[model samples]
Target: MTGIPKTYQRIVLAARPRGPVAPENFRLETLDVPELADGEVLIRNHYLSLDPYMRGRMSSAKSYASSQPLDQTMIGGTAGQVVASRNDYYRVGEFVGGMLGWADMGVSDGVLLRKLDTTRIPLSTYLGVVGMPGMAAWYGFNQILEAGAGDTVVVSAAAGAVGSVVGQLARLRGCRVVGIAGGPEKCEYVVKQLGFHACVDYKAGNLEADLAAATPDGVDAIFENVGGACLDASLARTNAFARVALCGLIAGFNGQEMPIKNSRLLLLNRVTLRGFIITEHMEFWQQGLQELAVLVANHQIKYRETVAEGLAAAPQAFMGLLQGHNFGKQLVKLI
Candidate 1:
């Protein structure tokens, strides 16, 4: 490959967090680009996705997936262009999305890579709305929630990547959507920008009352992202036979105990709650991505992003994301 850099920078997981993740948990290192194997592909990562799931991966505690190995490039999704290829299936100059981790560049054997089409959707979106986050929204709404016309759907962390999509999708399905976000700005964006019916500011110190006022008909479906108070408030407003898709528990991600205060409502209201990991259902990804791509390309589905420039900013950007400082999808522009 002509003009390929001899060395690249990558962020490695230097230490496991005892509680909240800090900058010290990651270490930046420079390494020589590895020689590609007979069936390998070299990728120059343009963007690295910063997701809440990566927080769980940082812990050694029992989880659905293995803990991220220490001193290794921190695991993450990336969108990039192939700089070199030794495989027939993928060619140099092709755009791709893969688990390339937090690096300026990486090498893969072509097994984990998926070719991307950036004609309509931007390449960075493949790591966002038309990618895993979008898939999670689609699958959770359509399969788990099973919401329909006249249903009141409440989405926690509604201004974020997955929650934003979930609310929009529910609205498209003729359901009334209410969003729960951090502050006035995010709440306003949820209602005005994302077209949600109403948005509750969870930071206003009146979550339960505000949520109740917003969801007058009671919440028929919930796409829960932040648990703790958000979940408790939503649970208190659940309608009979209400469906809940528990996608993330960001409120408790920093090792806080966030027990549900309204657990009795599950039995009282006959609520059906299901927690899912999107990776566990890879079969529906293609179908969901196709639908999401079309909607996004047509502008029926709008999304936002908060990008931090350079690979060096990932840890700080990630910390911001955890603290709800980001507007939507958070990414590190590695290029």
Candidate 2:
């Protein structure tokens, strides 16, 4: 970075969003890069991750995390290379991953950054299947859902990054896996590519009927990512002594309030529903990542990505992600 440009590009939250995020909610700007202090490193970001969880940060809601400040660089996961380093632990030119936000370059004190090995998998994958999303799936499905052989496991938003891994891992454990996705194309990918027993198209307008037809044995476990009608349908089809991983409520993230319509089923089915945030379960992450890395490296677990080119594309790409447009992991390429 001796002769590198002194400025960096970034996007910030222009205003707090009231409902569905519009392009107006974000602002793009450039600023001169600051000189690094001791124990700090300068990162030239190559990829920025777009996820449904970002929507929660835009609002001042009582969520698992605190609200992101307005008019600041929006919070997000990023993978990049260290262009300059004052930290002895990390060397320059080494790829790293951290929560560096939506920027072409960022500075860090090495507290949150992790060194990445691009020789094993694609560098961008650190933001997807081999990273946080994959850990979420592993912890949510194994520890929470607890589905085993002869059981039927159903996952909502099952074609996205986390859900894709959850269904595939359930299948590996010999469970009958069913996926709930938005469109016919995603449903096809969920069943054909991910090897789920069946996939129900929720956007097809017959969620209850489609789910019922897919899981005739009644859902023995659920790894729920989407809420609202998708959750309602799963609750209706759950079996006795079933377990559920209430991972995320993507359908209600944008201020849509959807009340559960079938509370009676919880009592009748003896279901166990637990909500979790992956960060809170850091104890399991190292083991989970090691296993997930092997699965990903050996192609035992498959994933897809819908990459949006450039940092400016992040805002629109994120809006599309909330609406279920991305195929697998939604990532913005900042190279």
Worst 10 residues of 1 by lDDT: 326-335
Q: Which stretches of candidate 2 lie over 4 Å from their true place?
A: none
Q: What's the TM-score of every candidate structure?
A: 0.99, 0.99
RMSD of each: 0.6, 0.8
TM-score (C-alpha) between model 1 and the true structure: 0.99
Count of clashes, each model: 0, 0
Alpha-carbon shift of residue 176 in model 1 (angstroms): 0.5
Give stretches of model 1 more than 4 Å off.
none
Give the per-residue lDDT digits (tens) of candidate 2, residues 98-202: 999999999999999999988878998889998999999999988988888999999999999999999999999999999999889999999999999999998
What value of lDDT does candidate 2 attain over all alpha carbons?
A: 0.92
